[model samples]
Target: MTSTRTRLTPEQRRGQLLDLGVRLLATRPLDELSIDVLAEEAGISRGLLYHYFGNKHAFHEAVVRHAADDLIAQTAPPASGPPLERLLTSVTAYVDYVIANREGYLSLVRAAAGGNDRLREIYEEARAVLTDRVFREDPEGHILLDTPAARLLVRGWSALTEELVLTWADDPAGVTREELLDLIAGSLPAVAALAR
Candidate 1:
């Protein structure tokens, strides 16, 4: 009997490793992820993993970056819709995503708070991307995040949304998903208005 494997380009192989890392991350904390374990999971050697990511910290950074990007991509708002409708749709998608990836989401948050500077940078960058999208997609000219104060308030709203969704996912506390979504989606304008 002969064993054979399909050959993949370096890019494809790296992407495959990152995808695997993200999947594993969904179920475990980042600190628990080891290069040796990941290499074994991929049927590769640890040296090969090093070739792709350089070192353990680099590998973790790459994995976190991929996860953050995936989260942002997953919750992207529809390209066409009423402004409020799009906001609600985006918020719904975000909530659904966090709920589905609850453990992974928590791990990411913990990793950031655990004093890993690179992970913290990746996490903050992800939040900034989401915040900028909200401003860029404001078709109604309502969320005028023009001034620094306005932008600060909108960022605060983003933080609130994240905290609310994470807490609400653990226990709804009698708040239906729809109501939670409404509160998150509807409050942005008011939150932004505070800077007026």
Candidate 2:
């Protein structure tokens, strides 16, 4: 096996393209995206775009991976504490991320639901990472006894949170972000108490 040297600073170029793709994700749905459109936006040719990613599916996969990796890194479980508190910290970080990067992340979620199969697969992997973290932070929560139970819990909680976030994004005036976080965190204690 021979290791080929990158000819045109491929690392930097790939970063630029991913960044470009992420921006496009926010503005336009992923299904409608084309390598030509991405190339025009980045002021690069389709050949150059192909060099970085073989197709739109590959490009979107990279974008989801990049975003998910960053989110996972940033929202890592808190150091040493009541699992509940650590869980809350992780959750708060999630809400904050949604508030700050609403368009980009939500688009990734939407794309995963019904976009390129490659990208959808990558996005599901990312979602699992996040859902797993939620479970980790709540090890003693009701879902611990079974994997399917845990998945169900995650789905319910995440759907509610997602709706709350969409509402927040739509009208920041009506609901306080802090209040939402409190309500979510409160559920943990309630659930944990019953489990005990």
Q: Identify the leading candidate in terms of lDDT.
A: 1
- For residues 121-147, what per-residue lDDT tens digits would candidate 2 score against the true structure? 777676677767655544454333336
Give lDDT: candidate 2, residue 86.
Answer: 76
Give the deviation of candidate 1 from the true structure as CA RMSD: 2.1
- Please report, as a residue range, the 10-residue window in candidate 1 with the lowest summed lDDT: 137-146
Q: TM-score of every model?
A: 0.91, 0.74
Over 1-117, each residue of candidate 1 has an lDDT whose tens digit, in order, gives 999989999999999999999988887878888898899999999999999999999999999999999999998988877767778888898998888777778888888788888
Root-mean-square deviation (CA) per prediction: 2.1, 5.6
